[model samples]
Target: MASFHHCIKSGKKGTAANHAAYIARQGKYGQREDLISTGHGNMPAWASDNPALFWKAGDKHERANGAVYREHEIALPAELTHEQRKELVDDLIPAMVGDKPYQYAVHAPRSALEGKTNAHLHVMFSDRMHDGIERSPEQMFSRYNAKHPERGGCRKDSGGKNRLALRDEVIQTRKTCAELQNAALEKAGQTARVDHRTLKEQGIDRTPERHLGPVRIQAMSEDEKASVVEARRDHLHRRAM
Candidate 1:
């Protein structure tokens, strides 16, 4: 099954540019030139504005710096060839970014010894718009309120009272991503698909296995292995009850 991971990175200490540069492989001595790709949607001309500037503008607040950018890592179906994977990602980008300024890069999988060779896409986007107008911290990051002192607010909730919370937005985004991925797989005649729901939500009753890192597992003593097995057995027994 395809794997889905999403996270938000804060630009609190003015490191947004660094993060953008890293993802875009802009600096010298960057690795794997063929592995890097970038795109932007609903954004100003690439010559004028970039991901760093987009996120920096959103984090103008001296205090209470909100999430400057969000990111997603989605595993591409291995059944598809390189060209098909690129097409799938191209289709996904526009759907994911909507009107917000965004940037994405596709990373190639490592050698076979590195484990799963699942190619994935990394996307980063600003939560605010690019209206070319200066805004206060509260105005830029907070919910929309006409009566408030600041101007040009962000998105609002369904009731139109407070700003739409990030948590809700993330959940919706995950569901949308799963649907889009499944569609892409179907188009490619691939049977593998992804799930956005948690194990409980999917009615999975078994205890999920803990991820022991490769190095830790390799170095584990026999006693340690037995301890882990016993712990997992106990967990499964409790869940069964």
Candidate 2:
């Protein structure tokens, strides 16, 4: 099943250029590349052609305490073909990233579990929305000027929201992802579907499975993995009872 995960990174934690390079599997990440398609869009003219230049500028110019980018690490259905998954992602980009300069890549890696594929997409985007005004790299990350918009930095979408509003935004994005995935599955004539809701919300009584991330799963011994599988089977049996 597909899963939704989102996070925002500040300049103090990491630079936007490094994150971009990681997603695109450039530089140091080249050895581990599982890239399918990578691209950038909705950027200022100066950095439109090359996303690296745009992100590098962001790293150099943004304030130390400021958020550099927001990332949505979304799992895609392995049942769908690569092209089908790409189509679904294409539809999603406009909705999630509208008018924001963003970079993204799709990757298909072998799953930790046997006979499965782990296909996913990562989108790294600026919270600042693109306006018509043209600003140099230095001015792009500066404080926004309300009265004279052109002289200021781009307007940010991540700020000014209360905790409740931010929570709602995350829930909405999950719902959107679920909807798109279900539609794609239907189009592909696959019966499998994904849910955005919690188990309680869906009236499921079983204990939710813990997420053992890819690295953890890969590190486990075969015996340990078998034990995990057996445990999950027992859990499911109990749920059925």
Candidate 3:
């Protein structure tokens, strides 16, 4: 139901590090900005939130990051939302974590169907009670690492047969949401915010795979792709040399 991936991105152009640049555009190192929009070479927002929570370097961090991404593919029903998301998450996480501890946050996508399902949870927590003496950042990070070993191991089947299943699930979720909302919309006699069928029509969520079987590989002409050796041989023979 969940997976994680962790990468140590820094303030770099064309990468997520750029996010810090936008937030810290005018300010000195410690000052805050007015309207922060993520930009190139920007400070890591997660770090800004809590310096102790900077991304660790390792495989486990990557998997927890992946678990967060997987939750998006699972697609929360629209009835579930920012407020409700946390409440349910609180309940569901216990099953995931037992009495051990961890910090977790949901990374809601801007749009669930954008293939941009990357908006995800950011959780850095420890199941081990810190003695405050022997524990290292590596030990803290390993708390999640030890708990979730499957991170970044496999991306959700955004390809092949599983791709089709994902499509169907997303579409159905939107439809169910639409039907319920519009029913409530009628109860209030108000206009609808969306058209679920329009989504299906537009191939946004849960549409069937185009399902074109066995892509026929067009053969390149032997004449067109002739190797240098073959071309030279042909040329020499043709010249009667």
Candidate 4:
């Protein structure tokens, strides 16, 4: 099954360029040597901004000057080829970010040692937009607009009546991803399909397994490995009972 992960990070003064460089894999911090390809969008001004200048742009209160960026790491089904995976990601990007500037990288899994290879996409996007005449952060993340309280801003919901939340968007994105993957699988005449719903929601009684990090598992001693295996077996046995 495919997995989903999303995260957001705030960029303080002097860090916007660094974050951009890291995502674009341009500067010394470009550590994703395993990437197959990298792509970017809507960041011409950010790309050219010097560190000092970028820092100055956010010279208001430290809080006001900081920018928030989002990162999403999505697991690509092994059933899809590299090109197909890239195409899927490309289609999803615009839908997610709209007019905001963003960067992404596609990574192929390292040679599998103990399990199936994992391919994934890493996406990073800024929270600001340029409307030809002006550039500003999305209203969803901005301070409350008292004049247009009904429109809300970042902190309040549309109409400023409630708190703005991203739960709905996150859930919808997961479902959309699952639908996209299922469509591809159907086109390929594959039997596998991904589900965005939780096991309980799908009426499945089995307990989900904990994710043991690959590096930690690989470094376990013989006794430690046996203990871990036994724990899993015991859990399954108890569940059966």
| Candidate number of the best lDDT | 2
- Candidate 2, 1-241: lDDT as tens digits: 3343433333432478888999999999999857888999998889989998888888777777777788777788867887899898997777777778899998877768543667788888888887788899889988888899898898888767899998898888878878888899899998667777887897878677788987898899999888977775575455445
lDDT of 3 by residue, 1-241 (tens): 1111222121211222122222333334334322212211111333434422332322224324422211111223333334544444444344333333233444444332222233333323222332223333333334332234332121222323477786686566545544544453344444323345553564545443232222221243434334522543453344332
Query: Measured by TM-score, how close is model 4 to the native structure?
Result: 0.66
lDDT of candidate model 3 versus the reference: 0.33
Residue-wise C-alpha lDDT for candidate 4, range 37-85, written one tens digit per residue: 8777765354433332322343332245455455666677777877777
List where candidate 4 sits over 4 angstroms from the true fold.
1-32, 44-67, 111-116, 136-165, 221-241
Residue 1 of model 3 has an lDDT of: 14
Q: Provide the RMSD of all predictions against the true structure, rounded to 1 decimal.
A: 6.5, 3.0, 18.9, 6.3
Candidate 1 lDDT over residue span 1-241, tens digit each: 3444444344453555566666677765276554546766655453235555555555564235445666676767666778888888887777777667677888765423224454778777765654554555445555554565255465422223345575677688788888877787888887666677776886868665666766776687877877876774565345345
lDDT of each: 0.62, 0.79, 0.33, 0.58
Report backbone clashes per prediction.
0, 0, 26, 2
Is 1 or 4 the stronger prediction by TM-score?
A: 1
Off by over 4 Å in 1: 6-13, 32-34, 45-64, 111-116, 130-166, 209-241
Candidate 1 vs candidate 2, TM-score winner: 2
TM-score of each: 0.67, 0.87, 0.27, 0.66
Return the TM-score for candidate 1, rounded to 2 decimals.
0.67
Better of 2 and 4 by lDDT: 2
